[model samples]
Target: MKNLFHSYFESFKGLRKEIWLLSLITLINRAGTMVIPFLSLYLTKNRGFSLEEVGWILTFFGLGSVTGSWLGGKLTDKIGHYRTMVISLLLSSVFFILLQFPSSFWAICLGIYLVMTVADIFRPAVFVAISAYSKPENRTRSITLIRLAINLGFSAGPAIGGLIIATAGYSGLFWVDGITCFLAGILLLKLLHPKRAKTEMEDTFIQAKSAMSDKPYLLFILAMVLFGFIFIQYFSTMPLYYSEYHKLNEMQIGLLLGLNGLLIFLFEMPLIKFLESRRHTATGYLILGTFLTGISFLAINLSDWAGILVVGMLLVTIGEMIGFPFSNSFALNRSDGKKRGSYMALYSISFSISHIFGHNSGMQLINRFGYEFTWYLMLGFALLACLLLFILKKILLRENV
Candidate 1:
């Protein structure tokens, strides 16, 4: 038993100190992630916006994210990941604070777009920082650790945000979120320094135009986009589902969503560590994981009970555990070593694209058809993603062969 415990922790061994610090920064920032998780509820319940309006606002937010992701890639390669992350983090804090002042529908929509654009630019920088700090063997585990921190913080955010909302309301939530982002930025600025040598520094001058030309990478991005489209339903629609259909309160909704992060914290690291040496490839994990993610939502359609929601969320969390780290590894491997930021940014754009389509289409479906139909449609999409990923795996193998 002791040996097993030790072996489980062995996966964490030898990772750079910067990786751990990066994870800390992620934890602190995500713990204050109050706005996005509850944005629909805030708009509909607090501000009295229609569901369709909320969808449009979210779409606008996604549009900015897509733009930020593209620009972030260009800047990361031009300046450096450290400066890019610091700038994004600090500017994001400003945007989050600015977000609270807008009351009109158009103003709120515009606010959301600006906030997301500045905030999301840090994503690729975070990926690049992880790649820069870790050794090859430790790369996948390093990314997992960062994600683990994010989930841990997410678990705290909604649970605590529920309390704050009940006591102080949405304005308090905004202040807390903005404050945490600022704190994270300050900490990152003080701790993270660029460690690249002269050769690595010169390599940054190399253009990332090559990544745009890679057909296999482009295909993989498409598959990731589909997975993202299905996965984002959790954020974009699930809260509304729990509230509208299940008639759950804010506290209950928060706890239900918090369960996702808690399950990831408890199970993901140990499971991944145990499986790391089983000779599994990222492709296999992606295929199995994407399929399970599909089945998770389908399970939701089988029952209306809250316990069933937990079970479905558990499946989703497990699938995330298997898929996400591998996806990061795959993206890193497929890109030029010096231009990781550009490749990862392109990869990050997949989520932004999904956000643009998923929220708008999901709410439209719910408004027109109902929630169950939305779930069914997403299930079909997930299955299609699985087929594409399978094809991707075959192509990858053929290229290697």
Candidate 2:
């Protein structure tokens, strides 16, 4: 047990201090991720919006995410990652607070759209910052560390958010979320001050290809879109599933959802460290991860017992731990320093596209065909993503040869 614990901590060694600081910033920002997880429920129950209206609002959220990601990339390239990230965090904090005031359908839609647009601008800039901060060999582990922070924050956020909702109402969630964002921004400015942190500059010597023209990378992005589409259903539809089908209350559902992040927080770093030592291709891990994720959906169908929900969540968490870091590394490895912002932006956009379609479609499917059918449909999406990844692996091998 002593040796085992030593090995786990050893995985964290050799990473730069900047990486740790970046992860700390991510943790602080994500720790207050109270609003989004509970957004659908708040819309339906508190605001008295129909499920269809909620779907449209979520779609607008996706649209804003797409816009933010693209803008962040362009801004990172033009102004640098540090400025982009700081600006994104500070501006989004205000928007998050403003989002609480809108009660009408169109007003709510516009509010969510604006808030997400500012909020998601953080994504690509942070990816670029990670690339700048990490060494080539330890980059994957660095990404995992950041993800560990994110999962840790998510682990706490839902449970605390649930308690807040029960006591203070949904409006309390927005204030906390906004405050955390502001705090994270201030911390970043103070700790990773522009003078202290390394700023990434475009390499004048290496000619970088535009991300839009990279066909193989584009195919990989498509697979990610599908993977994200399947995965996001957990956030959007699964909560409703727990409440309506499994007869779980808000607190119970929050704990169950929190279980996913808690599992990831505990296991993902060790798992990624093990995988990093292996000479496996990124696409190989992606294929296996997607298969596991698909199997998780089927796992839910295996038993009607509420215990099965735990089983399904565990499987999906494992798959996420395996897939996400590798995916980020793959995209980062493929890009030159000059165009990394564009590359990561396109990658972020893939998930943003999934957000646009995933929630609304999953809700529609459940309304028409029921939860069982929606799960099966999600399984199919995962299988399709696996297939695309397999093809991408073959193409990469051929190109390398």
Winning model by TM-score = 2
> Any runs in candidate 2 off by more than 4 Å, and if so which?
41-48, 159-173, 193-199, 204-208, 239-255, 302-308
CA displacement after TM-score superposition, residue 204 of candidate 1 (Å): 2.8
Q: To one decimal, what is the Cα RMSD in angstroms of model 2 from the true structure? A: 2.7
Q: Write the per-residue lDDT of candidate 1 for residues 238-301, one digit (tens) a residue.
A: 8899889889899998788777777777667777766677878887888888888999989989
Cα lDDT, model 1, residue 252: 90
lDDT of 2 by residue, 141-219 (tens): 9999988888778767888899988998888888889899999999889887684323465451244566888999999
Instruction: Report residue 109 deviation for candidate 1 (angstroms).
Output: 2.5
Which residue pairs come into collision in candidate 2?
Answer: none
Q: What would you estimate as the lDDT of candidate 1?
A: 0.83
Q: Model 2, poorest ten-residue lDDT window?
A: 196-205
Q: Which of the numbered candidates is closest to the native, going by highest lDDT?
A: 2
What is the overall TM-score of model 1 with all chains considered together? 0.88
